[model samples]
Target: MDTAGFTNLLTRPGPYATVLADVSQDSDNAAHAKELRVRAACEELSAQGAPPDVVAEVSDRLAANVRLPAPAARVVVATPEGVAYDQVAVAEVPNQVATWDPLPDLGSWIAARDSSVSFVLVLVDHAGGEISLWDSGLPRPTSTTTVEGDELEHVQKVQDDVGWAAYRMQQTTDNVWRHNADKVAEEVTRLVRDHGHDLVLVGGDPHSVSRLRDVLADQPVEVVELESGQRAADGGEEALHDAIRSALMDRVVRQRTALVRRLEEAWGRGDRAATGVRDVADAFVTGRVETLLIDPDALAGRTLDPADHPGLTFGEAPVSGPVEAGEALVAAAVLTDAQVCVLPASVLGDAPVAALLRWA
Candidate 1:
């Protein structure tokens, strides 16, 4: 779910197909068997009248995702005229029907690729810190950097000689923690500049996490302290994922709510909101749309002649469509680099598609 890679698939003209298959290997022949299954899926596309070249490329790409070593799952996306996007198993799910949709149904993919949303998770303690960059939406951290320092451990009680030693150890730990934070902040700034992650998550030693915020004060990113065990500790991934999952769930809904509010505000003022498919399509033609919103289940596979129906134009020629209305609007969203948001059926009310326009 690298943004650029996804944009290619989403914005392109169809006959694009998505194939999600179990590529897990159990035996010596497992890899070959997986290849055959994926290849067969591509053949099905060809049989369905997809371009021969596209099918061949798709097959090659799908095979590559599993390759010699087996994968847990595979998602293959191919467009006839554009580049193919193939990714190894990020999440384990059933072998969906080549998971084919007009455009690769990115909903699942986006949801599965947690790192795609752009965030930096820092796990820090007095001894060191770990920085995990979640920018490319890869199954693993796109990049990680660890900063190390003087060893520091807790002394539970302070009594006479033991108290003095404990206090000294604590002081050393504090200094090392402060130093580690500065170094971590420097690395974080570089990553933010290079990767553009907007959210910052911190977990680990509470004191380290607190010191981190002060050092990162000037960095332009939203930093949140998470309650969890550190990644370097046992069951780290699960703890990190649990916290991240909780954070993202709230974030996604808030984002959707904001988009809805934007749409409603524009409509209320009669400034530039396009409500319903017809108006939105017209907005696309005029290159007025800044955000494209749709109900994924509505108006699906519905086709209309540009000449006869309300046609959405992509701010260009072919001002109408015999193209499936849903697909056409998706293309328009991509063409204009507008944000594409799919809302649930109830949230969209009666509108199949809506647009927040760039201009009235």
Candidate 2:
């Protein structure tokens, strides 16, 4: 998903520098450090001229107290207080910070999907005193189970059962200095095996996450780590949000590529032609079309042809006449349920045509 761009959005100017100083100057600065870092991150985003709504989003994410709404384009988070909401540019009433309930949010996430069934796995790393998990497919915990013991031993057992499921687990910690780091890694492995999930998320201190990754270097699952502490069931919402974002990004890329390929192939046939709206409209009136691809821009100004063209076959006593170029093409495509590609200007340069109707 172009996370790099999103990550850049979180970058701030002075927060890191001040936070680093606190981390070095005081032993009790851990929590304070996190708060400062989060604040700094938010400030950085605000400075970038991110819409006020987007800025609020970063704030809400950094605050553990509030649960932001699902499918939010922008959110405002207040540390240990709660979250605020806005739509596009209009702000909405904020919700209170309540006990962590992953079920409802999970359900909402799943309902948004067009797919029938999906598998999701949640991985929590309490080693660094943080909880993190990845949720994909199926909202609401279908099953909740726990394992307790020496962290390392438990994670090893999980790995043995899951058979290389740790690779996709996000590395939350980069250091191995956390207490029971090994145990956290073991538990993560166990969770993956017990629940046949498609995605794995790891949450905890940097050190703890590093150790866990080292233990599960060969796993095949997709792992993601969050920059927060373990908080029981609360981590579910965050994990689900990350998984949804990841899934959506992948779907968009795949759809865009497929559409482009179909258009290119049709253009290569040479038999197909797309010029002004009239030419394309004539082709659709007859049954000589297979797929229709339209450039939203092209649709803005186009005129239909009067005469019926190739590929279209009307019933007996056909009423032949010109239709509004853009409207006619869209109507025909919809009526036939033909594949439609909404191309941008760049794609239009190569093929400004709509449907890949029949070959000339």
Candidate 3:
């Protein structure tokens, strides 16, 4: 989401020169020209006493790159303004940081919004019990808690919450089923109320979630039971992934749909002008193109013959020929990789190309 480092690279003379030259009426042309300039620069630097390693590094940096999309994973967990959820990040999981903050004000919500969280995990204490509610998008929390664990396990000592419950079930012969079921139902209902999202119940208790489902059969909410005996916060590595996936389903689908459309439009038209690729290219030339689309397959086998075309005019002057059309298009697409989608053929047919391009 932060492009500070990339921006610095672009501002450097070596890269900026190529970028500036590539901005023209023909985006593909511009892209090809930029790539040429970059390659040339790397060669010159290497020849001018730069270390081989340094030249290779420069070349690698300047080569084909994919731009990351804007941060959209923000999840806002709304609780009482002063309440803080107990949050911890399991070290074994990569690219995940978990912390609980008091939902103090709109400012805090906005600050949290910047995080691009895949899912929001809300830890709430209610009259029923303490439970963690998971929502893929930043949906609101719903629920109340009334039950208490027989013993409170510290974060480090716990490995699997749901597993522990399963162990208990296997050992007990009493009507623990009814007791656990009541508790799960109460906790799930409260979770739905607090988070305002659908529920995926996880824990060591199968009877608990199953019973909870039967009780909530009349409610509008959907409840899914996972067959793990893991605890809410200590469900180990696999559980963590499961929870995050459930929370980010909506966002993931939306992103995938947009990508498919862009790719389809780029390769769909039989004629460039009629299919709108020409118009899109013209937009790129005028710097009106906010996004570009290219087919990776189309690029792989393509070759350009710069010598085939004579002088190509830019502004008021004629630029020498020697540019291949395919090369130019590839360059243009790469230049706007942040705004480009290299999609498969299937995605293109089912999607709206122009809309996806604009969205990008």
lDDT (10s digit) by residue, model 1, range 117-208: 66788888767789988743345677789877655566566565886877788787778678877777788889888987778888888877
Model 2 CA deviation exceeding 4 Å by range: 1-232, 271-279, 286-288, 305-323, 350-352, 358-360
Give the per-residue lDDT digits (tens) of candidate 2, residues 1-360.
Answer: 111111221122211100001111123454465466556655664564444554454455544432222212122322112232211111121221111110001111111221222233334444333323332322344455453423332223265645444532323222223445556556556666775544555554455566666765666666555444354566566654565556546644666677667667766876564544555667666655566555544454444444545544321113245433444454455445454445554675443455565667
Instruction: Give the range where candidate 3 is weakest over 10 consecutive residues by summed lDDT.
Output: 15-24
TM-score of each: 0.75, 0.34, 0.33
Candidate 3 per-residue lDDT over residues 242-352, each given as its tens digit: 655554554545555765544455456432211224444444443444444444333333333323322212221122443323334333333443244334434444222
* Decoy 1 TM-score against native: 0.75
Model 2 weakest 10-residue run by lDDT: 14-23
The alpha-carbon deviation from the true structure for residue 211 of candidate 1, after best TM-score superposition, in angstroms, is 1.3
The lDDT, on a scale of 0 to 1, for candidate 1 is 0.67
Q: Which stretches of candidate 1 lie over 4 Å from their true place?
A: 1-3, 6-40, 65-83, 88-116, 135-138, 150-173, 235-237, 304-321
- Alpha-carbon deviation at 216 in model 2, angstroms: 24
By lDDT, is 2 or 3 better? 2
Off by over 4 Å in 3: 1-6, 13-53, 56-233, 246-250, 258-279, 301-338, 349-360
Candidate 1 lDDT at 52 equals 74
By lDDT: ranked, best first: 1, 2, 3
